[model samples]
Target chain A: MKKHNFNSGPSILPQEVLQQASEAVLDFNGIGLSILEIGHRTSWFVEVINEARALVKELMQLGEDYDVLFLQGGATTQFMQVPLNLLDKDAAAAYCVNGIWGDKAVKEAKIFGNVNVVSSTKDKNHSYIQKDFSVPSDNVYLHYTSNNTVEGTQWHTTPNTNLPLIADMSSDIFSRPVDFSKHSLIYAGAQKNAGAAGVTIVVVKKDILGKTNRNISPIMDYRKHIEADALLNTPPVFAVYVSILTLRWIKKEGGLVEMEKRAKERADLLYSTLDSLPVFAPIVAKKDRSLMNATFTTHNKELENLFLEECKQQGMIGVKGHRSVGGLRVSMYNAMPISSVQALVDLMIDFNRRNG
Target chain B: MKKHNFNSGPSILPQEVLQQASEAVLDFNGIGLSILEIGHRTSWFVEVINEARALVKELMQLGEDYDVLFLQGGATTQFMQVPLNLLDKDAAAAYCVNGIWGDKAVKEAKIFGNVNVVSSTKDKNHSYIQKDFSVPSDNVYLHYTSNNTVEGTQWHTTPNTNLPLIADMSSDIFSRPVDFSKHSLIYAGAQKNAGAAGVTIVVVKKDILGKTNRNISPIMDYRKHIEADALLNTPPVFAVYVSILTLRWIKKEGGLVEMEKRAKERADLLYSTLDSLPVFAPIVAKKDRSLMNATFTTHNKELENLFLEECKQQGMIGVKGHRSVGGLRVSMYNAMPISSVQALVDLMIDFNRRNG
Candidate 1:
């Protein structure tokens, strides 16, 4: 049986990327040393990071003003770093809390500076992208999650904001083409669509940093990382190498344009199947549905375990929803094949036939 | 020709460990999905982290009061975090500045609290560990780098102090058996003696936390990571897995005792050769020489380039000196075999004979 991996983050990656990554561990570029043993300052790894950074810019269509950084610590670390580097002690940053990640971001931001909760969907159990929000008059930036993995909601378009925008694109980045130039800073944990777990990719406009008056630690400071060319300290070498392989795969497979096509096809196929079945119900507002993760449940709650048991029997890994939200979740990242989604739909339909 | 890699820090790893790490990237534990795609919260990864943590305690001969965490970012992040967690704004921490890393650590520590420069070898260009100093009664902790990779100086004995000791054993952590209970906290970048580059091993005593009246960010707080069991966020999954593999190799090869024995053999072989040849001069005080790194240069300044050229021809990699202070440094971390050090010794003798 073909296994369909639907892990939310630290999610699926291309097969070729995994292959190359594994080989590099044994012998990196035939340099007679494992990539693990290679020095970060060596030309071999310098080229690896350089190419990875270049590919990110090329794929995002960003200009020279933007600098790409591969830093350690995940997007969770960025939640505080964003405000620490960009938000001053007296300033307030506008935030839209649509899901778990958004709520966490708000909490972290509040510790660093003033946070204005412009919009929140927690009232509705975060099943919709809260679009109605008034940005504060003196906001430093309007921060929002571009895609909510746990909530199964995504902003179809960029938020309408003139302030320097900060987006946590951890789950849904690189799945579609957006005018990436509009945002002052964009951060994503490489575990999702970007690459592997461990490293984080930050695309930031250089001028937005150093504006805050507070003393930020060197590792937490974005300007320090930018000045060091992301080599401020020993970076996550293997993680960055894997990211390079992933970026190369993305470019070779026709960039974000092709990725969007695949994402839409997978989401559409699964959502349509849920709608067709009378026994199944899809969660989240249809207008705000995520093309990356589709959340759904059966009307009879007791059948959830049986449905999951069937999923397990067929070699579907990590299809269970997050513990906080108990339901089935089918995550379809850029690397997820349509066949994987179709397999889940088949399991769901067969489950309905037996249980309904 | 077989390659002898002596890259400091992100240096060599066991061949068997590298093989296992490479295999896991393809299919982890014979599971259908790549290790890169596995969720951090899964039982598989949880088991891995648990075992790795347990191994750190067991190897160090520490008790339950100590907690181990595999963190992202390198030892650099720990420099500021050590003070942020332990040092209050009104308090002071004692520091020993021996080399580049120690100087950086002091600079970061001063940001959070007053730093008492109890000892320093900077006057002597950091060639020897300045042991003669007094620990202030008002100091919170005594901090020092157990081994300085750049200056090739190491503390032959742990610094004498009643203050809670904090050591950055980044380069030479697993190479010797220390009285681990002496230090309240120990942090090492996993690139050297632990496993890979991305993860950092932090063995911290549980009771030392919560002393500071600071609102530390959840990610930077050691207590928070201990509470979360090192899964505070999506950890560098692949990096931790590599660490586990390396730990397993260390345990199988007789743990720290065997590691120390091999380290002594390599260091003695290289130092004796350097002492025998007048053309090749070893740096650092005779007693202060590092068992993990041997720093030296030819007496003739003009022959330095020629010696490096001959080293390269003999397939010696990363034998070049630190860019800041020029001279060759051969770092023989736990993973470096005795054979590799002998090869370098042979090459040095050949160069000396030709140049003499």
Candidate 2:
């Protein structure tokens, strides 16, 4: 059976990337040693981490002023790391509470400094992105999740803010192009549009660090990591290697411009089908719907499981929505082909016709 | 070419584990989903992390009171997290500074609380483990590196401490059995004796946590990770899976007892050869030498590179020592076969004969 992977993340990766990653595990670059066996500091691996970092910088169209680091503990770790490094004690940091991830990021910031919630969509079940947020002067940074996987909403525009903008691009990074040079820092967990689940890519503007007078633990301090060039300690070697492979694929497929075209195409197909089907409806505000995760629910809540069962039978995996948001979600990352979206659309149409 | 792998971790792993791990990257369990492509919360991956955690407990011979967590960030991250969760601002942590890792642990702990140096062998270049030192009674925890990879020393016995005991067994874990339940906390980066590089195994006595009362960041707090069953955030899915396969290999190979036996056998062979050879010298205190990493240098410093060149010619990988400790280190972990040890010993004897 040909299975279509629609799981939100640790989601889909390009086929060639998977092939190379699999081979490397057994024998890395024809080196007698498995990648699992090599030292992190070895020339082969240093080249890997260095190349991966360079690729990120190139893809984001950023310059020498921005440094790329491959850190561990995923984007969630960044939730606190961002505040721990950037937010000064007594000075406030601005945050937007749009979903669970954003909410969690806010909670972590509160521990380090006063958090000013400049915007929130939580009041409406995070159904839409807030547009009129204002970051107060003297705030250290304005933070928001660029895409909410659970809410199935994405901020297509970078929120207008003068405070050094920080975006958690974990779920929708590489699915489209943005003004990457504008943000002071952008981070993405590799599980989504990148590669595997272990590494987190952090792109930070070099000048923004060391201003917080707090005695930061060296590992948590961005300045320390940047000074060492992401080799301050042993990194997650295999995860970074896979990220290199995935990033290479993204670049070879004509960079984020093409990724955006494909993303819009997939999202359009799924959304147009949902709009025409009276029995099914997208739960997120139409303009705010995520290009990565397409969330919807049936007019009859009882039919959600039945539709999921139909999806399972058709070998469509992970179309079910998050437990928090009880609906169906079709996650189409950059690696997701238009055919997979068409397959899901076909299922939805078939499901709606019979149920209606 | 049959290569002998003695590189330090992300070192050697069971050949069978690599085979299975590689295959799963393409298609996991005949499920048509690459392990990389599955959602972390899905039942398939949940079972992997659970099994890896359970395997750690069973192999350590600890009961259920010790909760195992597969966290991201290497054991280095635990340097700060241990203090963040265990030490209060007023309470002090007692540490033994045996190597750079211990020094780092001390530095990170100082960020959270007062640190008392219980013992230190740095005065003699970390050539031996410090003994006959006392940890103060009021200390939050007595911390030590069970194995110093750089200095190449090992603590054969757990220190006698009335304070809560914590061990960073990043290099020597699973290579030997000890009174594991005696410690309040034990952590190891999976790259060494456990599995791959992306995950770290944290075994903690449940009662030891939640006592610090110092507004610990939930992610940094072990209690939260334990509560969520190592799924608090996206785990290193593929790394944990590889750990599952590696742990299963350990159990199938007769658990830690047999592993310890093999560790002794390999170390005995390598040490005996070095002791007999007039051209070679083991740098560390003989009684304190690590069974995992055997660090040594040539009697004539000029011959060191020549020996490494010979090692490279024989298809031995990662034989170079860390620059901080400029000497050759042959790391023979659990998966290292005695034949490879014999090959190295054979080469050492042959070189000694020609050089002498």
Candidate 3:
């Protein structure tokens, strides 16, 4: 079966990227050496790291003020690290808890310093991003998840915060261009829109560092990683390599502008199909809907099961929603082909007609 | 060119494992979906995690007493985590500082609690593991690195300690079977003997968790990970899957006993060849020589360069020594074929004949 993958993360990558990545695993850069076997400190591997960092900056339009770092651990580690490296033990960091990912960030930040949850839609069951949060003036920084893969909510616009804004853009980074100048730091786990898992890319404005007085471990210290150029230790070489491939793919496919256009189209098709279907109901408020993950549900459980079964039979994979939010979710990340969305829409329409 | 890879970590995997991993990235387990595209929470991926976990336990001959975990952030994260989860803020942890990795472990542990340097070979430039270390009586646990990839030192035998023993076998795990009952915890970054980068396999005694008074991040808490079956967050699915393939390869090639036998043969050939070469000198004490990484150097820089250049020309990759310890390092890891070591030996012999 020709599967159409809709996994939220550790998610789909470009076929070309997969092919190229696989070849590198066997023989990286025609060196007859598997990427897994290359010394990270070697000139060739260093070039791979440098090129990948450069591509991220180029794609994100980040300037010299921003230092792009490929660190180990995932966005979860950054949850604590951001606070550990930024917030003083006595100070507090403002967090907007819009969904599960945001909730996690807030939870992790609390471990290091005081966490002021400025706004939360947890009361609303995380149905949408809270747009009217009053930013705490005294807080170290404002933290928010760009897109909620589980709740299927996304911030349509940047939060108005004078503080250094830190965004966990794990689910929606690079899907569209944003003002990199507006935020002090942006982190994304590569499993989503980037390339692969294992690496967390943090683009930090260098000046934002060295404020926290806590004794941070070298691995957890953003300054240490930035100074070492993300080679403080042996990095996730293959993950970084694949990310570069994905970045190149993004560039070849016309960068974020084109990516945004395609993402909007895919989300529109899927949402419109859901809205039109009597059996299926879109979960999140349409205005705050995520361009990356589309969460929905059918009125009938049997029909929902049948729809998922039929979708799988029709070569659609990972359409099942998170257990926390038990429903169907189609994560149309940057690598997700629009045709895959169309196929899902067609299947939904047919299923609604047959079962309704 | 046929490259003979001897990288310390992010090291070479079996060619067949690489081939399988590459194919799976395009299409996993005949699911018609790329492995990279699958949701980790899905039953399909959950099975991969379980199987990988099960394989580790099986390989180690570990019973239910040990809980296997697949974690991110590598052993560096674990350095702090092990103390954060196990050590009370008032307690001390004993550390045997044999090499750079052991020193790093001690440094990271100091952040959480007092770290007692039980013994150290720093006086001798970490040339060998100090066999006469006294375990601190008041320490909560004793920590050591089983094999030093950089310093090229290996513990010929496990240190006797009354306290809970923790080993960072990052470079040597699964190369051979150790007495797991002797240690309360053993953690390894999966780039060397196991499989690839991004994932850290930690086998911890279940009872030792939740003793610390410190507020630990959920990701840093080993019990939380074990409770979640190592799916605390989205895992590096591709890395885990490749590790599973590598584990299967190890099993098919007759398990750890066979691996140890092959490792000994390869290391013996390389070490003996280095010893016989009048121009070159092996760095580590013969009794403490690493069965995984063979480090050597020459008195003459020109001769060293010539040997390295000749080896590179003859398809030996990653032979350059670590910059911190400048020389030549031939890391004959578990997946390294003995024939490759023979080829390396032959190259060294030919080079010596010309240079001598």
User: Ten residues in a row with the worst lDDT in model 2 chain A?
Assistant: A296-305
- What does candidate 3's lDDT look like per residue over B189-303, in tens digits? 9989888887888999987877777888887888888888788877888889989999999999999999999999998888888899887799999999999988889878898
Better of 1 and 3 by TM-score: 1
Ranking by lDDT: 2, 1, 3
- Model 2 C-alpha lDDT versus the unseen true structure: 0.91
Candidate 2, residues A34-128, lDDT tens digits: the string is: 88888888898999999999999898999989999999999999999999998877989999989999999998888899999989997899999
Clashing pairs in 3: none
Error of 1 at A181 (Å): 0.7
lDDT of 1 at B117: 87
DockQ of 2: 0.84
Cα error, residue A335 of model 2, in Å, equals: 0.8
Best by DockQ: 2
Error of 3 at A272 (Å): 1.9
Q: Which of candidates 2 and 3 reaches a greater lDDT? A: 2
TM-score of each: 0.99, 0.99, 0.97
TM-score of chain B of 1: 0.98
Pairwise DockQ winner, candidates 1 and 3:
1
